[model samples]
Target: MVEDEFATEPFEVAWAGEARWFLQFLSEGAGEVSVRTQVSADGLVWVDHESPALSGPMRGVMTVPVSDFGHWLRLVVTPSSGDPSSLARVYLALKE
Candidate 1:
């Protein structure tokens, strides 16, 4: 189960036409998980995107779209409430 917060590797997305993040929880035992779409100018300082934060059940997948996010992108994951994530994965998709 995930106890601490999670952050994905910084991605430079200057050429990508579209970007989306998929977050999944492997088990139903864990509570809800939340994800924030963040952007950075230098890959260090990050701020939330205009998109709404993602939060939902622990057994399904939640997706967040990103746009106007400058050149750098990443995801920050955390437990929405209750128990932490039993098993979780975050995937980023970029369109050409």
Candidate 2:
């Protein structure tokens, strides 16, 4: 189940040897939103795993592979034309 909440900061998840992850975003307002996947070994320093995973409308689902990723993963969101209140809910799931 997804614990619905607005994303005010980078949302992080611990890598538990999952082969893939799924991210879902639902927006309440109209705007351009960018969501990028980042990875870090120590969880202190992070690097972008790929190009902007999702951009444009803030509502969609993204699938991320963990083959070359670190032990930690996160989503860095950048929204234009809207504030943090524009985000309605976010969900993440893991697949082995």
Report the number of the highest-lDDT candidate.
1
Instruction: For model 1, give the 10-residue run with minimal summed lDDT.
Output: 24-33
Candidate that scores best on TM-score: 1
Q: Give per-residue CA lDDT, model 2, range 68-93, as digits (tens).
A: 56466666666655443453444455
lDDT of 1 by residue, 6-82 (tens): 78889999888899998777767456777888898899898888898877767778889888888999998877777
TM-score versus the correct structure, for each prediction:
0.88, 0.60
Supply candidate 2's per-residue lDDT for 75. 62
lDDT of 2 at 26: 59
RMSD of 1: 1.4
Which residue pairs overlap in candidate 1's backbone? none
Candidate 2 segments exceeding 4 Å error:
1-27, 59-67, 82-84
Q: By summed lDDT, which 10 consecutive residues of candidate 2 come out lowest?
A: 1-10
